[model samples]
Target: MRRALGVVALGVLVTGCVGPRPAAPVATAIVAPPAWRTALGPGSPVRAEWWNAFGDPVLTRLVAEALANNPDLGIAAGRVDEARAAERLARAQLSPTVSVGVPTTDSRALNAFGTASTNLTATPSITASYDPDLFGRLRNASAAARAQLLASEGARDVVRLAIASSVASGYITLRALDARLAVARDTLAARGDALRIARRRAETGYTSNLELHQAEGEYRATEQLIPQAQLAITRQEDALSLLLGATPRAIGRGAALTALVLPPIPDGLPADLLRRRPDLFQAEQTLVAADRSLDSARAALLPNIALTGSAGVILTTALANPVGIFSLGGSVLSPLFDGGRLRANVDLTVARRDQAAFSYRRSALTAFREVDDSLAGVQRSGEQAVAIRGQRDAYAAALRNASNRYRAGYSSYLDQLDTQRGLLTAELALVQANADRLTSYVALYQAMGGGWTEADVAAVRR
Candidate 1:
C-alpha cells in the first residue's frame, strides 16, 4: 500500500509540474517613417554603412578599427552578458530543486534496572521541491526576463550606432577643418604677394604709402586667420583621435572635403522602419517587457501552490544524549488579505506598461522626423551648393582679371585684394557646402539604421 501511494504521489508531481508560455505583445502604431528622398538621382535602397560612400580606404579602416576597439562597445557587450545571465536565472526557476543525503545518529539510554543501551543508524533518501507554476507566475517572470534580454540587445545596437556615427561625424568635421586650414594658408600667401608688390611699387614711387600700408595690414590679417584655422583643425583632429580610442597622434587623412561624394538618398518604404531602426526596436522590446511584468504582477495575486519535500536524517549528537530523525512535507500559500497590496502592484505594472507604450510612440515619431529632416537637408544643401558653384566660378574669374590689371597699372591693389578675398571666401563656402551635403547623406543612412545585421542581433541574444 505504501509503495502504491509513493507511485501515485510521483505521478501526481510529474503531472502537476508544467508551465505555460505566453504570446508576445505588440504596441500601438505611431506615425510611419518618412520615405527616403530620391530626387537627387535614381537609386535603390542605400547601404547603411554610408561612410563607405566617402570612397576612402583610410577612412574605412579607421572606422572599422574604432568600431572594433572601442572600450564603450565592450561595456555594451558586458550588458548583453548581464541580460543573458538574468534570462538564464529566470528560466532556471521552472525546474525542480532536488537534494539527497544520508544521516547517522547514536544515543545511550539507561533502563529502570540500571542497564545502558545505544545504537547508530543511517537513512539515505532523496528530496525535491517545486513551484508548479500553474498560475503562470514563473512563466511570466521568465518571459519578462527574456524580453529584457532582447531589450538589452537592442540597447547594445543603439550604442554601436552612436559610437560609429560619432566617429564618422568627427572624421568628417576634421577633414572639413583641414580644408579650411589649407584655404586660410593659401589666402595668406596671396595677400603676402600683394603686400610685396605694393611695397615694391611704392619704393619706385609708383604707388602711395597708404596703399602699401593697406596691403601690409591685409596680409597680416590673412596670416592671423591661418593660425586660428590651424588651431581648430588640431583640436578637431585630437578629438577624432580620442573617439578612435587613441592618444592624439599625427592623424592626417588628407582627402579633400570636396572629393567626398554624397550618395543619393534612398527611397525605402515607410513601413519598413518597424524593423530597421534599433531605437524603435528597443522601444518595442521595452513595451514587451512591461507587458510581461504586468502579467507577473497579476499572477502574484493568485494563490501560490508549492510542493517541498525533504528526506534528510536529523541527528542530535549531544555527549549525554544523541538522536536522529527523518521527515518529509510541503507548504502551500495563498494571498489572504494583503491590504490591497496585490491590486496596487498590478495597477502599478499596468501604469508602467502604459508608460513604455508612450515611449515607443515617441521614439517612432522621432525616427520619422529625423528621416524627413535629413531628406530635406540633402536636397536643399545640394541646391544651395549649386548656387554657390556659380558664385565661386564668377569670383575666380574676377580675381584673375583684377590681378592682371593691377600688374598692368590699370587697377588699384585694393581691387586685387578685394577680389582675391572674395574668391577665397567663395571657395571656402563651397567646400563647407559639399561637406554638409555628405553629412546629410550620412544622417539619412543612420536614420535608416546602419551597421545592425541579423548576425549582430543573434550574437547579442547569445
Candidate 2:
C-alpha cells in the first residue's frame, strides 16, 4: 500500500502520469505560381513512360532494358527493403513478451532418519513482461521508422528517373555518331572523285603540280576522318554498354537524326512539379523522420513504467505432492541525474532536424532550376539547328557553282575547296545541334519527374 501511494505521488508530480509533451512541428507554407517562367509549348501531361515521346522502337527497348538491369536501381530497391524491416522491428516493441519454460530433475538423498530416498521433481513456469507507452516513446520511434521507410521508397524512384534519362541521352548520342560517321564517309568519297580529276588534269598539262598536291592533301585529310569517326563510334558504344550494364558490343541503330522530332511538354505550376519529383519527396520524408526522432528524444526525459508477472507449478513424489505459485509486480524508473546525456540527445536531434529542413528547401529550389534550365536549352538548341541547316544549304549551292566555274576555267581550285570544307563543317554542326536538342528534351522530362511513379514500385514489390 505504501508502494502504491508512492506511485500515485510520483504520477502527480509528473503531470498525472503522462509527463511533459513536446510540441509538433509547424507546417511549412509555400507559395507557387500557376506556370513556369520559361516558354512552354502546347501538349498534354507527360506520361510515366515519357521516353515514348521519341517514337523510336529501339530507344524504347534500350530504356526498358536499362531500367530492368541497372545495378544502382537494384541497390536502391534493397535499401527500401532494409528500411521496411527496421519499421517492423520498431513496431514489435509495442507488444508484450511471454515465454514458457519446463525443467525436470531426479534427486537421490539420505533423509535425517538414515534412510535413502529417491525423488523426481518438475517445475513449469510462464513469465510475461510489458513496458507501457505512458510517455509515447515507443509510438514516436515507430512513427520515425515508418517515415524512414517512405523516404527509402522515394529514393528508389529517384534512381529510376536517372536511369531512364541516361538511357535516352546515350541512345541519342549513339545515333548522332552514326549520322556523323555517314557524313564523313560520303565526304571522303567525293574527295576521291575530285582527286582523280586533279590527277587527270595534271597529266594532260592543264593544271600545275601545286594544284594536284593541294588536291591530294585535301583527299587524305577527308580520308583520315573516316577512321577517327569509327573510333568515336566504338567508344560511344562502349559508354552506352556500361549504362545498360552490358559488355561492349555493337549498339543497335534508331531513327535517323533528320527523322527525329522533339516531343511537346506542358509547363505546370511549381507546386505540382515539386510533388512529382521523387527527390523532393525523399527530402520531405527525411524531415518528417527527423522530427519524429526529436520527439522520441524529448520523451526520454520522462519516467519508464513496466509490468511483470509469473506463474509456476511444482510437482514431486512426496506427501505434499503438487504446489502452485503466482506473483505480480510493477516498476517505475524516473531520471534524476544522468551527466546530461538526455539533454545532449535532445540537442543532437534538434540539430539533425534543422539540417533536414534546410536540405528539403534546397532540393525544392534546385528542382525548379533544373526545369527552367532545360526549357531554355531546348529552345536555344532548336534555333541553332535551324540556322545551321540554312548555312549548309547555302554552302551546298556555292560548292555547285564553284565546281561549274572550275570546269569552265573561270575560277581557281581554291574556291571549290573552300566551299567543300564549309559544307562539311556545317553538316557536322547540324548533327551536334540535333543531338543537343534531343538531350535537352530528355533533361526536361526527367526534371518534370515523368518517368516512374508509385505504381511502378508497387508492381516491383508485388
Candidate 3:
C-alpha cells in the first residue's frame, strides 16, 4: 500500500512537470492600398544596386565605398556578430556537457598489515550532466536567441541602406554646389562686361553717371556670391569625405545633374513593404523574440529533470589493487515557492510581449508613412525642377533683352539691374530644385530598403 501511494505521488509530480506551453503570438493583418496615390513611376522589383539607377558611376562607387568603410555600418555589423554568438551559446545549452578530471595524491600511511607505506594514487574520471528540457525551456530560449540574431541582421541592413542613400545624396549636393559656383562665377563675368559697357557708354555720353554707379554696385554684389558659393562647395565636399571614411578633401566630380538619367519609378504594392523595409522586419523579429521569451518564462515555472553520471578507475599502490566505480542518478526540482517571483517573471515577459506587439504595429505604420512621403517628394520635386528649369531659361532671355535695350537706350539701368537679379535668382533656384529632385529619388530608394540581400549580410559577417 505504501509503494502504491508513492507511485501515485510520482505520477502527479510528472504530470505537473509538463506544465503549460505558451502559444505563439499572432500578428494582426494590416491592409494597404492597392496603388499609391502619388504620381510616381511604375513599381518594379528592387534592384541590388539601386544607386546605379541614377546612372552615375561616381555615385555608385561612392556608395559601395561607404558600405565597405562607414563606421556606423561597422558598428551595426559588430552587433549582428554579437547576436549570432548569443544564439550559438543558447543552442549549446540544449546539449549535455562532459568534462574529464585527473587527480593525483601522494600520502604516507599505515597499510592494513600495520607496515608503514608511501603510496601514490591517481584517479581520472569523466563526468557528464544533462538537464532534459521537460517543458521546452531550452527550446524556447534557443528560439528567442535566434530571433534576436535575425533582428540584428535586419538592423545591420538598415544601416547599410542609410549609408548608401546618404553617400549618394551627399554626392548630389556637392555636384549641385559646384554647379551653383559655376553660375556665380559666370554671373560675375557678365556683370563685369556690363560694367565695362556702362563705363564706355558714360564716356561716350550714351549713359549717365548713375547708371555706371549701378553697374559697379551690381558687379560687387555678384562678386560677393562667388566666395559664398565656393564655401558651400567646400562644406559639401567635407560631408561626402566623411561618408567615405576619408580625410576632409575634394571629391571626384560626377556627371552634371542634367546628365544623370532617372530610373522609372517603381510602383511596388504597399503590402510588399513589409518584406522590403528592414526596420519593419527588425520589429517583427523583436516581436518573435518577445513571444519566445514569454514561452521560456512559462516553462521556467515547471519542474526541471536532470540526469548526472560518472565513471572511472581507482588504483591504490599500498594495496596493489585496482577498483572501478560508476554511478548514475536523476533528479527533479519543482519550484514550490519563491515569494511569487516566478509568477512575476511570467507577468514581466507577458508585458514585454505586449509592448513588442505595439512596437511592431507602430513600425509598420511608420514604414508606410515613409514610403508615401518619399513618393510624394519625388513626384512633386521632379515637377518643380522641370518648371524651375523653364523659368530659368525665360529669365536668361529676359536678361539678354534688358542688356540689349539698355545698350540701345530703350530701357533704364534699373530694368537691366532687375533682370540680372532675377536671372541670378532663377539660376540658383533651378540648381537647388534639380538637386532636391535627385535627393528625393535617393530617399525613395532608401525608404524602399534599397537592394540589401541575405548574401550581402553574409558578406558583412565575414
Q: What does candidate 1 score on TM?
A: 0.81
lDDT tens digits, residues 153-227, model 1? 778777766776777777778788787888888888888888888899999999789999989888887788777
RMSD values for the candidates in order, in angstroms, are: 17.4, 17.8, 17.8
Residue 416 alpha-carbon offset, candidate 3, angstroms: 0.9
The residue pairs found clashing in candidate 3 are 41-265, 42-266, 42-267, 43-266, 43-267
- The whole-model lDDT of each prediction reads 0.72, 0.79, 0.77
* Decoy 2 TM-score against native: 0.84
lDDT of 3 by residue, 1-462 (tens): 111111111222334453332231221232111221111122332345777788877777677667666788778879989999999999999999999987989999787899987888888889999988989999999999999998888787777777878898888888888888899999999999999999998999876898899999999999998889877877787687677666565677769977878767633333443355777778889999999999999999999999999999887686667888888999999999899999999999999999999999888777666666766777888888888889889988988898898878898989989988988998999889888888887887787667434443343335
lDDT of 2 by residue, 278-344 (tens): 7887898899999999999999999999999999999888648689988899999989999999999
Error of 3 at 118 (Å): 2.4
Best by lDDT: 2
Write down the TM-score of every candidate.
0.81, 0.84, 0.84
